[model samples]
Target: MRWWRQLSVVLALLCGCATSPGGKPPPEGNGPPPPVPDTLPWTPCGRTAIPLGPAPEESDRGVPEMVDGERALFFVAEAGATGQGVWASRGTRGPGSCLVRVLSPGPTGLGPSEATRVGNRVFFAAEDPEHGRELWVSDGSAGGTRRVKDLWPGKTGSEPQSLLEYNGLLYFAASDPEHGRELWRSDGTDEGTVLVQDLDPGPEGTSPDRMTRGGDGALYFLAHFQGLSTVLMRSDGGPGAVELARVPSEGGILESLTTAGRRLFFVMGHLHDPEMHLMATEGGAPTLVSMFAQVGGMAALGGQLYFSATTGKAGTDAELWRSDGTEKGTQRVKDLRAGEAGSAPGGLTVMGNRLFFAADDGTHGRELWVSDGTESGTHLVMDLEPGAGSASPAELMVAQGNLFFSAEVTGRGREPWVSNGTAEGTVPLDELAPGALSSDPRRFVRAGEDVFFTAADGTGTRKLWALPLRPQGQCGASASWQALRRDVVTSAR
Candidate 1:
C-alpha cells in the first residue's frame, strides 16, 4: 500500500468509531474545550463541536495536538475530493472568533497527519504535488507551515515515521535515496536536519522500529537486518548507535519495548515463549527478568515496571505483574481470580502514586482496578456495571491530575468518564451519544485549558469535541460561554 494509505488505515484503527475490535478496549487510554459565539459551533459544559466536510466525508480520525498554549493543529481529509488540509483553531475561546482557520487548503490537501509537538512547533509528515511525503513544521499558522527539508528532494518523499522528541530535537526514521531508511533528527531547520546514523550501512538500511527513549536520555530501537538478525541498539546522538542484543533469523520477535528509571525493559521471543529482558541504559548485557505465556500493558511507575501476564510457559489467564528489573522482583501482584481463571489486567496507567487498569475478578465481570505495587493495595476501584456485567474501561489516561477513560455501562454503552482513584470521585461526563448507544470516545488529548477528542453524538457522526478540563460548571451557563456569546452579539452591531 502507499504510505498515505497505510497511515489512513492506522488512523482508522486508532480512532475507531462505535466499538473497538474484538469487543475489547485498546491497551492505552489515550482532548479540548470551548464555548461559542453566535458564529461558532457549540456544545454543553462550555464545549465546542466542529464537523469537517459534509456528511460522508468525515474529519480525519486522529487526536489534535496543541501547537502552542492556545492553538491546536489537526488535519481534514475527504475520500475523493479537495479543499482539505492542515487546520487550526483561532486560539481564543470567549469572543466572536472563528473556531478554526485553514493553514493549508488545496485540491488534494496536504495529507498532514501524525503530528508531534516539539517546543512551540508541531512537526508532521505532509504530502503535496511537489514533495510526496516529507517532514513539515508549523507554528499553528499558514505562514509558519512549511517543509523542513526535502530529504528525498523530488516527488518521492523521505517517508518519515516514528517522530519523537528527544533531548530537545525531533527524531524520526525516514528513507532517503542515499540512506534507504535510517535514523534522522531535526532541529526544525534545513541546516539542522541531518542523518544521525546508518545502522545497516548500505542501500538497504537497518529500518529501525520500536524506537523508545530511555530514562537516561538515550534512543533505543530495534534494527532488523533482514536475513540476518534483529539488533537491539541505543544511540546518544554522538558518533554511532550501540548494539546491545540480537535475535538471529526467525528465532522469535522482540516487542513491547519500554523503560523505567535507568533500566530499559522489553520482551523478546514470540508468544507462548516470551522472555522479559532488561538492560541498563548506561551499558550492559541484556538480563532475563522473567518468562510469561502472554503479556502486555507494560508501563513504568516510580522507578519500577508493571505489566499483565500469565506466568510460566503455558496459561490462558493473565494477571498483573511488576518488576524491579530482576527475576525475584518480577512476580504477579495478585491472582485476582483465585483459581484457574485470571484477572487479565490491561491498560495499566499511572495516576498519582497508583496504577489503574481493567481486570476481571470472578465476581464482577470486568471493571476498573487500581494498585500500589502490592497485592492488598490492588483492588477494584468500582464495579461500574454494578453486577456481573463488565464496564470494560478502556483508554485510561491522566490529564491535569485526574484519570480519564471510556467505560461501558447499563444505560450508557460506552462513554467518556473521569476518576480520582475513588468510586465516588469517578463519574461520566455529559452523554455524547445518549440513550443505550455509545459515542465510544477515544484519544483524549489536553491542550491549554481543555481536552479534545473525536466522538459520535446522537446523529452518529464523528466530529471534534472539546470539554473543559474541570467540567464542573453547569451546561451552557459557564462564565466563559456567556462572555463569548455576548461578544458575538456586540460585534455584529
Candidate 2:
C-alpha cells in the first residue's frame, strides 16, 4: 500500500479565510475606510490544486521553511504535469512559483515529508514509485540533489521521521526487516547512515518521536516499549542511547514534552488524573510541577513558563497560568471561562513582551487574547467570533514582532489573522477563499517583513502564500499590488 495521502476534493471543508486587518464593524453612518493600499508579499506558486490526486477540500498546507541561508522558502507543492515535488520560491505569491526551481521532479508524483535543514542541505523523506520512500538531500539545485540511502530496500520504505540534526549528524527513525522501527543516523552517506540502536530489540517497534535536544552531546526523545509504555530516552547517535524514565502511562502515552530554560516539562496520566512534571534530563526522577486537572498547550516566555490548564475543583475552570518552574509561582493568569466550564486557553505563543493565545471569555465566545504574564493585563483582543461561539484562533506564531494565526469569522471558516496586540489592530489578514469558502492557512514561516504560510484554494489544493506583516502605507488600490511585489521582493531578498 502506498503511504502517500491526497486531500479529498469532494469533501467540503467548513474552514476560515484570512482577510486584511481592521475589518471590524464601524459606527452606524461611518463606512469602512478605503482598503489599505499597499502590497502584501503573498505569492501563489505551483499548482494551487493538485491534478493527479484528490485535492484537499479545506487546506493545501504549504509549510514554508528557509533554504539557501534563509534567502527563499522551500516546500512541497503539487503541480499537474510535474506531479508532487519539492519547490523553492523567493516569497513569490504569484501562480506557478513552484517553477522557480523544481528541486525534485517526480513524473509519477513525489511525496516529501519530515523536511529539515542541516547546515547548507535540506534532508527530507521523499517517495518515488521506484524507490518507495527514502532519505533524500538537496542543496536547492538539480546537480546537488540526490538520494542519501534506501534503508528499507525496495517496495517497502524506511519511512523516515523525526528528522533532526544533532551533534553533527542527521538523526531519524527507520524500519527495516532487521531493526523493525528503531533509531538511525545519517551523515548524508549510505554506510554512515546505519542503525543507531535497536532499542526495542526485535519486531515489535519502539517508535521514537520528537528528537529534541537535551544537553551538550545527545538528544532526548520519547519511545514506546513492550507494555505500550512511553519512555523518556536520550541518544548520542550511537548504541549508547539510554532510557531515562518509563512513564506509568495508563493510556499508553506521555502527553507531550516541551523545553523551557534547561528543563523539559511534560504531562502524564489518564483522563481523570493528569500531572505535569519537569526534568533536566532522562537521568534522575522527574520533579512533579503540578497536579492540575490537565495541562495542554505550553510556551516559555521571559524565563517564565505559560500554559493552559483546567482547575478540576468546585467552580473548576480552565485558564492561563504561569510559573518560574515552581509550584509557589504557578497560578492562574485569568478566569477566561469563569465558573465550571473552562475557557481552555491553548496555542500559547510569544510576541514582544506578551504571550498571545485563543480563549473563550464567557462573553465573546472563543477569541484572541494576550497576556503580559499577569492577570490584570491579560485581556481579550477582540470579539472575533462576536457571540457565544469560537473564532477558535489557532497556530499562534510570530514574525517580525507581529503575531499571526488562523481563526474563524462568523461567516468565514478558519482564515488567517494578524494582530499587534490591540483591539483595532487585530483583524483577518485576507479573505483567501472569501465568503463561506475557507482557505485554511497553515505552516507560517517568516522571512524579513513577510510571513509565509500554506493555504488551500476553494477547491482544496494546497499551495504557498505570503503576507507582509509589517505596517506599510497605501500605494493606493491601483498601485498596491505592483508596489507590494516590488517592496516585498527587495525586502525579503
Candidate 3:
C-alpha cells in the first residue's frame, strides 16, 4: 500500500459506496445486534517512555535497521532540539534503553529514511551541509557514522532510494547528475561503493521505482522507459538491470511488490478499470487471478498469500482475498458484511494460525476481524468503537506474537492499540501526553524485547516511543471471558 486508507477511498469510488478513511459508512439495511459491552475500561500499558526529540508530525517513515553485532536496531530519529540522526535502541524497558547519538547534527535532519543493515552496519542517505543528502554508513556508534561516497560530489547529492540488501551487497537507485538515475551497489565501503550500470544512459534516467526482491535471489524493479511506459525490470547481479516485462501504468499501479512463497505478487491495472489483475513475477507470463481485484495490501500466511482487494462485488468488495497462484485458487475469503454491504477489510496480517484485519462487517462497524481461511471461520474479533464510527485499524504489525496497530476512538483520537485477537486483549497504551492529544504510534520495528516506534505528542509533534513487548514466539492469545466481560463494558463505550 502507498500509505493507509488510500485503498478505502479507491474501494469506495470503485464499488459505488462511501467508506471514510477514518471510519465506515452505515450499511443499507439495519445494523447488527448491539454488542454487549464488557465491564473493564481502557487498560493502560505500564511501559517506560523515552523522548527521542521532535518530529513535528506523524511520518510513517522511521525505519529500524538491525545492527546484528550489538543485537540492536539502528535507526534515524529526531532527538534533542531539531536534531535528526542515527540512533540505536537495544529494545529493553529500563534505564538507558534508548540511545540517542546524533551521527550528523543538522537543523532539518540527517534525512535517513531507508537504512538497510548489512553485516552490523546500516547504509542510508543523510543530509550534510557540505554535500546535500548523500549515501552514508553507520556502525551504530558516533565514530563509525560517515558518508560512503559522494556520487554527485559537493552538495549535488546522488539522492538515493530503496536500500535493498542481498548477496552480501546493498543495492539501490541513486540520481547521479551526469549518469542520471541508475542502480548502484556497495560493499559498505567507499572504494566498494560504485555505480553499477546505467539503465537509461544520461540525465533523463530510467527512474527505477518499487525495487523488490524475488524468490530466486534476484532483484525485480520498475523503471520508466520513455515516460508513459512502465517496465518491470530484473537484475540478477548481472552486468546491468534489464526489462523483464512491460506493465500497464494507468494509475502508477502495482507498487505493493511482495514476495509470497517463491513468487513475487503485486497488483496491475489502471484507476477506473475494474479489471485490475493480481499477477506474479514468475509462473510463465504472469497469471491474472481476478477480473477486478485491486490488491491494496498483501501478507503471506500458512503457505498462502492473503491480501485486501477491492473486488467490486457487493459485500465482498474491498474484503479479504487469497491466492494459490491459480485462477481457481484466487477468490474472496468471505462476504463478511453479508449480501452486498461490503466488509472492506484492510491491513491484512497473519498471526499464529489466523489472519487478522480491520473490517466493518455491517454488524460490528469497523473493528478487528479474524479468519481461519474459511468463510464460516471468518468473524469479528472485537468491537472497539461499537458503532458505525469505527476504530479503523491500519499499519498492522506483529510483535511478540501480538498485533499492534493505530486505531481511533472518539475521545482518544488515533493511538497505538495492542490486540491478541480478542475483546479483552484489544486495548490502547493509555499514557498521559501533555493534554488531550494522542501518542499516535507508527513505524514499529521489533528488536529483541522491544518495539521502537514514533508517536505524536499532545502538542501534535511527533516523537519516539518504545513498548517492551512480550517475548518472541510467545503466544499472545490471552483473553479470558471474565476479562472481556470486564474490559468491554467501559472500553467499547
Candidate 4:
C-alpha cells in the first residue's frame, strides 16, 4: 500500500472522526467540503514523500543539513554495508528531487561520519582508507571530493572529529600519533592544516570534543584535562588556550555549549541531574541559571535564551524554560502541568518571535510542540496519529515561517514532517516513499521561498530533500491549511 494511505489509516484510528468546533458535524458535505482555513493559529501541516536514492537494505541514516541555499545532505550508515557515505539532494520539492553523489571513505570502505557547512563548501570526517579518519571537503556542487588533511599522515589517526566554523576557519579535533585528540584548523586553503593546541597532548591525556563557537569571538569546547573530569576551554585561535571552567567534582559533566550575545550557556551535569548554566566570554565563574535540574537543548532568540527543563520529578514530564541571563527571572514559558504521565521534549529552533520544539505528550508518540513565551498558550500543533509506540520527532528547523522536522510515525519508521504551527497545519513532507524514514531535517539555508533538509530513506539510503515555502496566492487560504488537506489526504489517505 502507498505509505500515505497507511499513514491516513493510522491517523484515523488514532484521531477518530473529524468534527467541527464544539463537536458539530460538517454541513452536508458531498463533493469535498469547503477548504478549511489553512491559517489556524497553531495547527500542523505539510506532506512527506519518499526521497530519490538507492535505498539500502538495513541501517540507520541521519544528521541532515541544508547547505549552500540549494542542497540537502545527510550521512548514511549501513549497519553492515561497507563504504557507507553521505548523499545529497537538490530542489527540496517536486519531481526534480533526486540525490547527488559525493565522497565516502572507510577502513577499506567509507564509514559513517558527521557533516557541517561553511560558506559554499561542506566539511566532514570519515575513516580514511589509510589513516583512521581525516577531514574532507565538498563544494556541495557534485564533483570529486578531496581529503583536506591526513592529520596523522603515516602512523594512526583515530578520527578527526567535530568540524566547526569558528574565527574565520574550520576547527576540529583529531588524534595524532604523538598527541591524543588535539585541536586542528583549516582555512579551506593550503595554509594546509595547523594544530591549534592539543587538549590532552600527553600519553594519558584525554581528547577534547564538542567544539562550539561562542559570541565572544572565541571557540568554546569541552575536554577532560585531568582525571576523568570534563572542563570547558576557550580558545581565540591563539597559542595559549584558557581553561574557563571545570565541571564540579560532584560527578557532574557538561554536555553541550551554545553562545548568545556576550554570554556562553551550556547544559551542565549528566542527564540524570542536569542544569542550565551560563558563563562570561572573558572567563569568569559559571552561574546557575535554572534550578530545574533537568535541562535539554538550549537556543538563544531575541534577547532571551530558551531551553527544555523538567518541572517535577515525575520523570515523564518536562517544560520549556526561558531566561534573560538572570537567575531571579528564570521561569517556565509553557504551563503544561505534569499529567498522569509526562512529555519528552526534543529538537528546538527559533524563528522570528517564536520558539519551536518536539515532544511526545504520552498520547502523540512524538509530535511538534511550540511556544511564544505565553504560559497558557503553549500546546501541540502537530499530532502524528496511531498513538503508536514509535512516533518520535528528531530535529527542528525553521525556514520561511514554516517548521520542518523528522519523525517516525508509520511503524515503517521515521520520516520528515513539516508544520506551520497549527494542529491542523502539520503534515509529512516525505510520506509517499515506502520505507523512507527522514531524520534530522534541518534548515541550513534559505533560497528564495524554499527550505532544504537532509533525510534518510528508511530503506537505509540517506539523501537530501527540499520544499518550497507556500507561495503567495498559490493556495487561497494559509499554506498551513492547504498543507493539512494535501498532506493528510495524500499521506494519511
Candidate 5:
C-alpha cells in the first residue's frame, strides 16, 4: 500500500471508523443521545460537547498530542490528495466550538508533521518540500506561529519528527545533510536549533527517532546503527549520545518506551512473541520483565507503570497489567477476554487508584472498562451498542474528579464521552451547535477549572473546545448537564 493509504488505514482505526474487507461501513448507533435539557443551567459544565471535523479527504489524521493544561491540541492531518500538514486546535469542549488553524511552512509546502507542547508554546515539524521536514513552534496564543529551523535550508535535511520536551528544551529527531537521523534541540528560540549528536555516528546509519524523556534527567530513544538492527540510546541533551543495548534482530522490535523511577522500560519483541523489558538508566543489559504478551498501550501513574497487553497461545487477546519495577511482581490487573474469538483492549489511562481502559466484550463492540487492581472489581463502565462501535478510548483524562474520554457511539461517528467510573456517570457530551459532527476528542488538558480538547466539526474541520468542570450539584437542581456542548464557531462555511 502507498504511504498515504497506510496513513489512512491507521487513521480509520484511530478514529474508530473501521470498514469491512469490501469497504463497507461498520455497524451503527452504540446508543441514542441523551434527552435534551429542559432548561439551560446557569453553569453547566456536564452538558458541553466538542467536535473533531472530518478529514481533508477520506484519508486520515493520526498521532494527536495534547498540550499540558489543555490549552491546545496538535496532530498530523494527512490527505492523499493534499499530502500532510500539522494542524492545531485551541480549546477542549469539542471540534466545532474551538478555533482551528494550520501552521505555516518555511517557504516550502508542509507535509506529515508531528507536534509536542511545552509550557505555553507548541513545537512541531513540517516538511519544507525543498529542505525536508524542519522544526517549528507555535505559541498557544492567537497569531503566535513561527518556524524555528529550516536545518539544511536547500539540501535534503533530515525529516524532523517527534517533538519531546525535556529539561526546558525541546528535543527531536531529524535527518541532516551530513548525518542520517540525528538528535536535535530547540531552546524556544529561532537560533538555538541544532544537531546535538548523531547516535549512528558512522555512514549509512540512523540515529534515534522518537526521543522521550525518562524519569531521570536524561533522554531515552531507539536508533538503527547498522544493518536493519535497532538499538536503545540515552542522552542528557549534551554532545554525547550513549548506546545502551541492542535489540535482538531476529524477533525484537522496540515498539514503545517509557520510564518509572530510575528505570527505563519499553515494549520489546514482536506481537507474536511479546515481552515488556526494563533497564536501568545507568546503562546495563535489558531484562525481560514480562513474557508472552503484546503490549498495546502504556502510561505511568503514581510511580507505577500501567499498560494494556494481550496474552494467549495465539496471542489474540488483551488485558491490563501493572508493575512496580519488578519482574515477578508484575501481573495482570484486568482481563477483558481480548484476543479470544474476537475481543481486544482499546485504550488505557492511569488516574488516581484506577486503571481505565477500553475493551470489546463481543456484545458491546468496544466500551470503557476500569479496574482497581482486583479481578472482582473489573467491570464495564459503558456498554456501547453496535454500529457506533466504541473500539478504543482516546484522550483519556481526569477533570474535577470525573473521567473524560473520546469514543464513537451508536449514532455518533466518534464523539467525546465522559464517565464518573459507573454506568450512571457515563454519558455523551452534547454539541454546542446544532448539526455539527462532534467526534474525536484528541486530549484533555486542564486549564484552571476547565478542561480543553481538540475536536472536529460536521464538515470535518478540526478545532479546539473547552468545558468548565464544576462541582456536582453546583449547577442547581433543574439544570441537567449530562452531554457535551461546544464553545467555538467554525469558519469553514
Candidate 6:
C-alpha cells in the first residue's frame, strides 16, 4: 500500500466494535431522517454529544473505523470508574442516532486497539481477564466478537503490531513463546492463524516491522538482527522471505519505508550523511537516488514523488522537492523562503492535481501552500493568518474534493478549517470551542458522506465531531458559518 492507504490502515487499527455491558440498547426508530438541506451543516453525528471519555478527563478515543459505510467503531479508555473498550456509532442519521458501547472491559481494561477490517469482519488486538492481550475478530455483534487465538498462550499476549491485509489474509508482527516476535498471518480462525516464518529462527525472532505493500502487490518490510544489521526483505506469500538489502547497525538509521511512483523508497543515514534508496519491483540491488541533509513528508503524483528536504548544497535549507526515482531527476522545486531558510514544506497532501502543504515563505509564517510540480505553479494559497501570522495548517486531508485541516487564527485559536485551494474559499469551518478557545480538531477520516474527527468542546474533553462531505455556504457555508460570524460580531462589539 502507498503512504496514504498505509496511514489509513494504521489509523483504522485504533478503534473497533463488539457488544458491551456498559452499552445502551439500540434506540427506537431513528426518527424521521432530517430533511436534506441545500447546504450541509457541521452537525455532531450521535444523538447527543456523547462524551466517550468523562468530563475533566479527555477521551482516549483515537481514530475511528467505519463499518457498513455508516457505523463508526472506536476504542474508549478507562476514566475514573468508567470501563475501557470498544464503542460504535449508529451512522450519520441525525439526532435520533446514538452511540453503542461494545466490547466490555477486562479487569485491567480491555484496551482494544489496532482494528482493521477484512471481508465481512474487523480484526483487532484486545485484552480480557482470561486471555491477556491477544488477537480478536468481530462481526459487529456480541456473539460474533471473540478472541481469534492466544498466540502467547497465557497472560503474556502475542502483542500484535502492524496489522495489514494482503492477499485476503491479515499480516502482523506478533510474538509467541516459540517464535518470539516474528511475522504472522490469519484467516480469522485459530487453525488458519499461524506464523508466516521464523525469519531469525530461535527465541529472539527477527522482529519484522514496517510491513507495507508495493506497487507489484508484494509485501516489503524491515527485519532487525541482534547487534548486526537490519535487512530489507520482500515476500510473495511464499515459504520464506527474500532479503533485498542490508544496512549495518553502525551505518545509520534506516527508516521511512515508502512506495511511490511504482517504486519502493527508503532513507538510510541522515543529517550529516543520508542516502535515499529505491528498489525496482522487478527485483534487483537497491539503487541510490540521492543524499539529503534532511528529508520529511513524501507523496506521489503523476508518477513523480514529491517531498521536503535540503539538498545539502549551498543556500538549500529544507525546500519542496520531487523525484523521478533517480539521483539526477531528484531536485528542489523552489526556494519559497528565498535565502537559506527554505519553505520547510510538510504535510504533503495530494488533493486533485496539486500538492497542499504547510510552509513558511518568511513573509507568510507557516500557512497553506500548493504546488503543481513546478516552481511557477507553486505559491502560497492564502495568507490565512494575515501578515506574517501563521495559520500553521496541519493534518491536511482531501475529502469530497476539498481540503480539510486544523488551522489557527489569531482570535479564533486552533480549529478545523476547509478550503477549495483558493484564497476566498479557505475559511474556518466552525469555532468548535466558542469564543477564542481552540477545539484543536484532528485525526480526520472520511467514511461515506461524513468526515469524522476528534476535538475538544471547550469542556477540555475531546469528543467526536463530524460534518457533511459537501456542506453549503461561502467557505463550506453551513449553519456552522453562523458560529464564526457570531464570533466575529462579538469581537467587533
Tens digits of per-residue lDDT for model 5, 373-432? 678977877665444454466668776557777765444556766666766556666643
Residues 179-244, candidate 3: write the lDDT tens digits: 788778898788998787777777888777677778766788877765777777777865656665
Per-residue accuracy of model 6 over 1-493 as CA lDDT, tens digit each: 2322332332233223333222233222233234457455433222122222321112244444333233343333343354544443432323212223345555455466666777656788877776677888865444667899999876778878878888888999899888689999999999999899998888888888788887667898888888688888889965578988887766544556677756877777633444434333435567878777667687888777888887555535779998888878887888888777787898999987899999998897899999999989998888878788888999898875678899888787898877767765566665768778998877676653456666788776666655644244422333343444444333322
Write one digit per residue (lDDT tens) for candidate 2, span 151-262: 8787677888888888767888888888788888888877888888888778877878877774234578888776557887866667877777776546434456666666
User: Which scores greater on TM-score, model 2 or model 4?
Assistant: 2
lDDT of each: 0.65, 0.61, 0.63, 0.56, 0.57, 0.66
List ranges where model 1 is wrong by over 4 Å.
1-83, 90-110, 249-253, 270-282, 470-493
On a 0 to 100 scale, what is the lDDT of residue 479 in model 5? 34
Q: Top model by lDDT, which number?
A: 6
What TM-score do all the candidates reach, one by one? Answer: 0.79, 0.76, 0.78, 0.71, 0.71, 0.81
TM-score of 5: 0.71
Which residue pairs show backbone clashes in model 3?
A: 38-488, 38-489, 39-485, 39-486, 39-489, 40-486, 40-487, 315-342
Evaluate model 1: give its lDDT: 0.65
Off by over 4 Å in 6: 1-82, 94-110, 251-253, 270-282, 313-316, 470-493
Name the candidate that leads on TM-score. Answer: 6
lDDT of 3 at 191: 92
Clash totals, every prediction = 11, 29, 8, 40, 51, 5
Error of 2 at 355 (Å): 0.8
Name the lDDT value of residue 355 in candidate 6: 94
Ranked candidates (lDDT, high to low): 6, 1, 3, 2, 5, 4
